[model samples]
Target: MFFTEMWERFSFYGLRPLLTLFMVAAVTQGGWGWDRSEVGAIVGIYASCVYLASLPGGWIADKLLGLRRAVLYGGALISLGHLTIGISGLVEHKLPFFLGLIFIVLGTGLLKPNISAMVGDLYPEGGARQDAGFSIFYMGINIGALIGQFITGFLGEKIGWHWGFSAAGIAMFLGLIQFWLMSPKTLANIGSEPSRHPDPAIQAKQQAQVKLFTGIGLALLALVVILVATGVLTINAPIVGTYLAYALIAIAFAYFAYLFIFGGLSTDEKKRVVVIAVLFIFAAIFWSAFEQTPTALNLFAYDFTDRMVGGFEIPATWFQIINSAFIILLAPVIAGFWTFLGRRNVNLSSPVKFAIGLGFAALSFLIMIFAANVVIGGGGIRVSPMWLITFYFFITLGELFISPVGLSSMTTLSPKRFVGQIMGIWFIASALGNLIGGLVAGNVDPEKLELMPKLFTTTTLFLGGAAVLLVILAVPIARMMKERKGADQPIDPTQEVPDLPKE
Candidate 1:
């Protein structure tokens, strides 16, 4: 599962560093020659779609294909999407490019959520070891990301854009093959079948619902096609981005409302739900800042930062390696620090950790303040690469503080019946952030380089203000999160946890 995800991320991240740059590249340079705003809109829409797809992806896995088959299908779709994009480079029309993105979006929606769910399934008896396992899995994700950027970034920039995109396709194909060969024996019993009600009547009802949904989905697809073909519908970057943003927020709010009004949750569960809602907002804010690395920050590396080191010009994409490297180096250290604190009975609640994470996030932009000042003071002279490196380091620190903790809290705080839904909500926050972050990055025009300082300053202030707000509310939120006596904890020393789902 870890390797599968690593390669998947490799392909995903590999494409990201190239997307905006390729969109805005001149015709002679094999790009669409779109403006920065357009590039931002495209990238933002693409990213947001990827995360948002997880909602239906999870639903499909649970109700239809089961995890194993869903993963295989998803991988195939992703590979095909990459190939389609590769083919688009040779064709005069832009249809293949957009079609390719559509396939990738659908495929990722199917794969991403299911794969992580399988990871949790690997350890039915969840314990400290489960947390350790996920850390290892996260490391795999970073490994793929680092290597993917190095390889694809080089190929895309130094050779041809199509070649870089093709590389991702090839990598994903290899991952699919690897998973197919090894998973049969290794995960024979895990996620092999759909989970369903044992009762015949209930099962029949579910089957009916699934069929109804399938018919509705197909009809909607056809409707969209007719609309597009007849000129009744038009699609562009901003329009798409705006709609996706609105839709995601609406879905999140509707889901929360349903859970509160109809979920039959206890008062304690309701309180925790409130915490989750607050955390969701915080998650969105953090990701909006963190996700800029692949868009706005990528542009920074290309246009504003000095890429020359000892007279040897480095690839702009190489700057991406810094964040991944920092994660690999710092993750274990941070994990160990948490463990050390845990052993001493010092519990840093999720809200507190998140607040600190926001601070670190702001600190990354704070470092950039100096870098931006240098460029402004020098009248457009590029700053040293070290400044970007420092910024990545601080942001990576913030990620370490927030991301893992956020995942842990999701599982711990959620009601068992809605655990999957809560996790989906978490991803939605990421989706929303990606969309907004892309817009933020799109505004970064290299020609108007003077705006860079203001951009960095704005990010710093936004992050800092969020951090301050979290700090002010952390105590109350943490209090809400505190486990009430005899609420969720095991009462007897030898009895198994009540909510542990049977295999």
Candidate 2:
């Protein structure tokens, strides 16, 4: 599972740095030559959809395919997606490129949440041990990311964009092979069957509902694709993105309302859900700022930062490795720190940790504000690479505070049957963040260099303010979490499944 996730992330992060750069590069340089805004809209939409797909992906795992099968199928699709993208480099048409991205989004949706759920399943006695396990899992993610960025950045920038993309596909293929060989032995019975009600009648009804909804959703999606393909339904990418963001927010709210009003949950379970909801907002905010790395910040590195050292120009994409590199170095230390605190019963609540994470994220942008000002004053002079290196460092610190910890918390707090869905919701927060970040990146026009500082300042203020708000509410939220019934009891794997409430 660790290697599977590593290879998957390698494919993802490897492709990420190349996306905007490939679009914006000159046609002669083997790129699409699109404007920053168009690229931003496309990238943002693609990135957000990658995470957004997790919702349905989680549903499929819960109701249809088990977690294990989902990961297998998702990996295959991702590999195919990358292959299609690589082929696009040889062809002149855009169809293959777009199709490839869609495949990847769907694949990630299935693999991401379910795999994390499986990791949680490994340690049913959830506590500091689970947190440490997630932290270790996170290291696999960054290790892949660090190596992927380096290899793909070099291949894309120094060789060809398609070559970099193809490399990602190959990595995923390798991981899939490893998983196919080892999973049955390592996983045994874990995640082997779909989650279902104990009553056969209820299970059958649930399956029927899933099939009906799935068919409807697919039909609608197909219709949109056909219309777009025929050019009969021309769409503005940015406008569509804006509406999608609004729709996502509405969907999240509706889902939570259902959970609170209709779902069969205990009072303590509801409290935990409420905490998740509150943290969701702040998590989205943090991601919006943090996710800028592939868009706004990537462009900044290419256009304004000094990449020259000893007559060698560093690839702009190479800068992305900094975050993953830091994660590899610091993850163990942080994981141990959390364990140490747990031993002493000096644990900081998830909300408090989220606040601290937001603060670091704010500080990261604060540094960028200074760097942007340098560009404004230098009048075409590129700033030092140290600016970006430092920015990534602080943001990485913030990520450690939120990401792995949040993953552990989700698995711990969720009702057993809803684990996959809750994990999906966690990624949904990331989806929202990526959407906003992409839109924000659209405003990062090099043509209007003066706006850079303003953009950074706005981001800084938003993060800082969110941090303050979370800090103020942290204590009450912590208290709510403590109210969980039998909070310290180990969850029984054989507990009777509750029937899902009818809509």
Candidate 3:
């Protein structure tokens, strides 16, 4: 399961780095010849759609198809989407490009949430096995990401964009096959038996979540299309960034209100939910900025950096590899560091980890700040590739500290019955952040950049402020997150993936 997932991610992320460049590249360069803002809009919208779709995907797994079918469907859609995109440029059709992007977005939405849910399903409730499994799975995520950079970045830049993209499509196709073959032998095969998602029971639950999420997503997309047609909104009004953020907040609140206020959760679980929601708000913000590496930051690499290295020019696509590479290298070390801390009787709570993570994030931007100075010479200068590498190093460290641990915490904290809904809410926070990240990128005034300092001072300042806020909340949130009688653990000890459908 892990390897299959990794392959799909490799395909997805491997293609990610090339997207902005593909959009803005000169027609002579086999691109659309769009401007930076135009490219940013496309990337942002694509990202927002992918994250936003997870809610319905997870709900479907919980209530209707179970984990296995959800994953199969998601993989098929993603494969189809990528294939479409691969052939999109063949005819030089802009609408084809947009349609291909939409397909990929929908496919991702269906796949991501359910896959992680399956991991949780594999684990027993609050068991050591589940914890270890998730960590290992996360490591696989980085591994796939690392390999993707080499394959996607290298192939996309060297052979043209479609080749890398087609490779991703092929990977998705294989992943679908791999999962199908493995299901009967895997825990997922056993867990998703008729007794687990009972035809009538889960089917009803899934119907509601799916109905709500799909209705909203489709409604928003319709508005976007209509407004764009009528000139009320640009093709990228909020760059998919703004709406994504808001949509997450909407999901979070709606679910929380429904579950706690009306749905009959215990007081302890409700309190935990409140606390988790606050934490999720921060998650949304953190990811929104960090996610820019592929969209806004990719543009930064293309326009700002000089790509020469020792008489050979580095492909701009290579920059995307840095984060994945950092994750691949650092994840094991970080996991070990946590274990070491645990053995030393010095466990850091999730909130403290978040603070520490935010602190680490400051390092990424600070590196970027210095890189800006590296270009300080009066004329055009590119920072050494090492700078971007180090920047990703910092970001990766922070992500390791917060992302998985926080996810584990949410599953641990949530009421068992609504785990799927809570996970969807958590994902919603990411949606918000991603949307904001796009908005920030879209609003970046390239001309005003000359009026300001070379360093991304505004962005840096915002991140710095967020880091400080996280630092302040570390202790309180930690205190609040302490387990209350441990009654909330899931059914199987394999809490690793929290039993959502396969993505």
- Cα lDDT of all candidates, in order? 0.79, 0.84, 0.67
Q: Candidate 1 — what's its lDDT?
A: 0.79
Best-to-worst TM-score order: 2, 1, 3
- Specify the poorest-scoring 10-residue window by lDDT in model 3: 494-503
Residue 31, candidate 3: Cα error in Å is 0.7
The runs of at least 3 residues in candidate 2 whose Cα sits more than 4 Å from the true structure, single-residue gaps closed, are 339-344, 485-503
Report the C-alpha lDDT of model 2 over 1-503, residue by residue, as the tens digit. 98999999999999977998999899999898987877887898999999999989999999988999989999999999999998887887787898899989989999999999998899887655665566667767888898999999999999988989999999999988888899999999898899989999999998898889979987887788788888988878788889989988987898888988888998867877887788788888898898899989999999888899899899999999998888777666676776677578665777888898899999999999999888888875788999999999899889888776667667877888888888888888889888877777766666888788889999999999999999899877755544453645434211111111000
Clash pairs, candidate 2, are none
User: 378-460, model 1: which lDDT tens digit per residue?
Assistant: 77777788899999989988887777766656666667556555766778888988888787776566567677778778888
Model 2 — which ten-residue stretch has the worst lDDT? 494-503
Question: If the candidates were sorted by their lDDT against the true structure, best first, what order would they fall in?
Answer: 2, 1, 3
lDDT of 3 by residue, 286-333 (tens): 686687778766766766677877797677777877776777667667
* Model 1: pairs clashing at backbone N, Cα or C within 3 Å: none
TM-score for each of the candidates: 0.92, 0.95, 0.87
Error of 2 at 425 (Å): 1.0
